[model samples]
Target: MQTQGHDLVSTLDERTSNIRATIENVLVLPLSRHPSPRSVLIIGCGIVGAATAFFLARRGVDVTIIEREGPASAATGAADGAVSVASKRPGPMMVAALSGVALYRELLGDGTLTDLFKPRSTFVVAASDAECAVLEAHAGALRGEGVAVEMLAHETLIARFPALSSNVRMGAEVKGDGHAIGYRIVNRLLSLSGVTVLRGVEAYHLVEAADGRIVAVATSRGELSADAVVIAAGNGAPTLLNCDGVMKPRKGQLLVTERAPALNASMPGSIMSGRYLLSKGSQKGAEVSARGYGLVVDPLVTGQFLIGGTREDSDARQTNDLEAVRHILTDAVAMVPGLADIRLLRAFAGVRTAVIDGLPLVGRLPGRNNLFVAAGFEGDGICLGPVMGQAIAAMACGETPSLDLSSFDPARFTSLEVAA
Candidate 1:
């Protein structure tokens, strides 16, 4: 695939050069540029931070990523890596998802990061009438954006996925959505030229000057100075920020199944509940009310089934909650009957940094010129990683983001009056 894409790029370049006279006749605007930062300190080496470092390094910016543990050891290491556009909300989120998919496709063509991505179909099964209604609404909204969404009736869905429960009323299928290997992506990005990966060094606090620009960072190992800093520390951001309203931790528990003949077979990308889809922007009425379950069964290249997860409000780092694990497994079995025979392999948990608003804090910090943030992605960090990285690099380089960032402003939580 990499060779094929490269050949296409070369062929296109050659052909375009053949028509150089016509190309020269076309008008083009001067590209805007920014003074590159002398150095950038990224405070996490998860998927988000690693990708951010990769993008910044690609632009000739010096980037040092400091991780308390090894790269992708946090949420990125634990996530199921479902890169599904169907999982995202409509409008801005849909646009971001599409852009993120495109970026991943481009990366897939490089072979350097090929192990991190794979194409798979995704399905959303509806178990009840209410769920069916929600799926209809979701499919309708997605189709309006020209996204391919097929709504399958009960008989068709059951025939296609015999492992599904007979109670399923319908299912929504999205063809282009797929899964990626999160840890592999982290490794690939960390191997880039200009990225310096430092582990076992916990960043404790941001050292701000009188002018309110972050000048240095105080870590357990030592203090490091950089021209700019990005706080991509996932759930650990609140401790680093020490700001009451910046962000909070939301815990999610997941369980994995040992590879079995039934489970090892090729499966769709992922299946999300309608409740989960509509719960994005607003959490007020979106709380999982009934049994509170959303199960995503992702089949990895290694033949293991990555089944998950349950959302909780507590910030505890507990990974072995037998009850929560059982709930997740129970819900998963209900969604995919074949999963019932699979033996439980392991269970774990991770905390996602969630802000009051659904959007992530992806730009420069308010009042702190040199301090930038790309946290508060909740559980969707994997789906949004590449795009967020590109956007953060643009902000660090003083270039305008391709998308309007007002909706994700960190100031929405930390106001001048409140900070004062």
Candidate 2:
């Protein structure tokens, strides 16, 4: 077993000359202007913050992104870039996902996102009876919402995807979903937005007026007086806002294979498991797993296969979990035996903030009207980041958001607010 793992890594490096980098480090394209922002101090430079700055800049809002690190250095950088609705459990999460999917199409339609976006047919496969039932119900829910979904039975699953093993019992294909590299989207959005990015700075405290309106932020760099403050910091947002235990960091791992177009007809789109279903939130449709060892196979546009992951709730920055890698490999090989033959280029890991209820915080705090937060995406940040940014930006400009934010109110988890 040890020899096989060594061989897999060694063979891939020899075969592929160049493979794209994952989430820890995002490429920064040099920009000419660094505008002064008297409007809003947006903390965190990940996808959510960057997107907020992106749309806000378009609306002529003076926005500044203060980051402890560079852009896409958190969950946004480490994600598989799945703009998928298939993984979301039915209800509010699914509703936001549909809107997010539509928003991504609009972004792609414009010249904003070029070769970065590509259409994918998402396939959700299940190994057990429990998992299959969940997949079916998921397909039904999506269909009811006008999402294009088709169920593939055992025979059809094998016929369409010969790479999968005989044990594969069922599968469902989700249409109209697409894929994008997380870092690419963040880097491109920042480059195009031209917002002031203050890297290597930390937001220490959020200052507010006597009337409870947001005023300024005391940071490591200096005092940043702002008309408003939008906090898009991932796991760090809770700590800064004194809402610590509410948003916890959930770590994930993924392995990327070398360019192998022959790997399951280029693997079409992402292959998910019903096990993936259980992690989103409380769903009675079927019990998958809270930490879904669910398998996701993404065929990259560059002809690589991105397979992931294990969900661990810890703040430890260690991304390489040997045990998690083993489970991921075993799951990948069982579903698609062809994956065993392919060489693995590298394994990537990152942490995402997960809300216990499995929904992101996207609106204003109960008390601080001028303070807004967009965090706790847990792995869904890539899909919802753009729309969340657009919505938050509109709010900062004193305009109503385009999408319904009744579900993502930050006060839901607050004892006082919830009691009220």
Candidate 3:
């Protein structure tokens, strides 16, 4: 009688398991049959590459992001998260920045990515009457684009940012501008579902078919075959692509200050000089007037202050440029008097992948059917990450991107013969 009872219980348990399995299959059948999913291989794990992986994974693409060392160990790791509209070019880049800001705000509201972002006002200070006029024009142009901008006098600028030096001539206040921590954002995106992050793996070459379709990627560890691949390896991209003169590594030095009470209270948001915000294309005509220095200060939530940086037009990996550090520190202290007393904590450097045309290359590679390129962000990768990822994922999935990306075409710098 005891043996018969045990057998009956086992039978009932098996029946319950079968019922549950049937229900699960019924629930997942529609989704599985919607479309055949394709696997994607992202070549870098910086902000641009990680964010691209996140966006693609969210769209149900099987994503595997391979990094040489670790996530954000390159430019994204050392970036100062200044998501400012002032830093971008006038047209499509600016539009994309604004769109990314909106997406960040939405993510914050949804509590999905709140820890990665912080909302703060951004200011552009002018040091002379000419710069003040330029600020006025910039403010007007931003306002014309429906962005919230306020022009403030020197006195008003001093009052609003009490830490600002009295020599500030004028300022433009952008209400919605803020900063996002880059590495944190990358980690958050990596933790999402449908994404596989492989650190300490270096991508070496692209394995393409005779038809010019990328079929596999050769890496230091091994080969990874994918339906599509995105090259976002920052300055390392040009080396991997074997494409000459497509990307160059521009070094930037930054410094951090020990946590200080005086500096905490006067933490002015992302600050920029009017000349620094001028179009890079206009630098040739105003080379003598342009200052190679820009100051950005943010009082991190940890109480430590972040200050940066000097754009050095070199590809070297030397981070200990004491002269550049001294210049940056002097300018930062000049902008925020309270920062003068702060103790120097540490200094670091990052190489920004810059393009000759001063815009990131996005979209499919010319003559390559399944390969894509999304690098050369320079200093704006953190700000441009989301939109670039969205565009890349859209192209991979055969969907139309929400934003127009004509300005970021890969063939823009290439001749017809080279592109073909």
The top-ranked prediction according to TM-score is 2
lDDT of each: 0.71, 0.76, 0.73
Which parts of model 1 are misplaced by more than 4 Å? 1-34, 261-263, 278-285, 288-291, 416-420
- Record all residue pairs in model 3 with backbone atoms less than 3 Å apart, i.e. clashing: none
Ranking by lDDT: 2, 3, 1
lDDT of each residue in 1-420, candidate 3, tens digit only: 112234433543453344334333432111121222356778998988888876776665667777888998999988888877766666677788888788788868876577668887778888878667767877876776678988888888888788788989989888797788888888877765335567788888877665666666777765667677788899878877676777777777788889886557675566777766652332223331122566677777678888877676744584767788888888888777788877999998888888877778888777876678899988888888877887788877777788788888888866312221
What are the per-residue Cα lDDT tens digits for candidate 2 across 1-420? Answer: 112234433433332211112111222222212232236778999989999987876665556778998898888888888998878777887888889888888988886787888878889888898887778888898898789998998999888877778888998999989888888999888777666777898988876655766566777865666566788999888777676567777778889989887774646677887777765442553432435566788888778889988777643474686877889999888888888888989998888888867789988878766678898898788999999999998876667888999899887877422110
Candidate 1, position 106, lDDT: 81
Ranking by TM-score: 2, 3, 1
The TM-score, computed over Cα atoms with residue i paired to residue i, of candidate 2 is: 0.87
Model 3 ranges off by over 4 Å: 1-37, 278-291, 415-420
CA lDDT, candidate 2, residue 98: 89
Q: What tens digits encode model 1's per-residue C-alpha lDDT throughout 1-420?
A: 112334543543443343233223432222222345756789998888998887876665667777898898888887778887887767667777877777788878866566678877778877777677777877887787778988888898877777677977889987788788778788877654335666788888877666666666777765666778888888767677666565666677777778775555635456665555544422224553322456677777777788877666654474657787877887788777888877888888777777766678778877776678888887788878877988888888888988677777777775422121
TM-score of each predicted structure versus truth: 0.85, 0.87, 0.86
Model 3 sits at a Cα RMSD from the real structure of: 9.0
CA shift at 219, candidate 3, in angstroms?
1.5
Worst 10 residues of 3 by lDDT: 27-36
Name the top lDDT candidate: 2
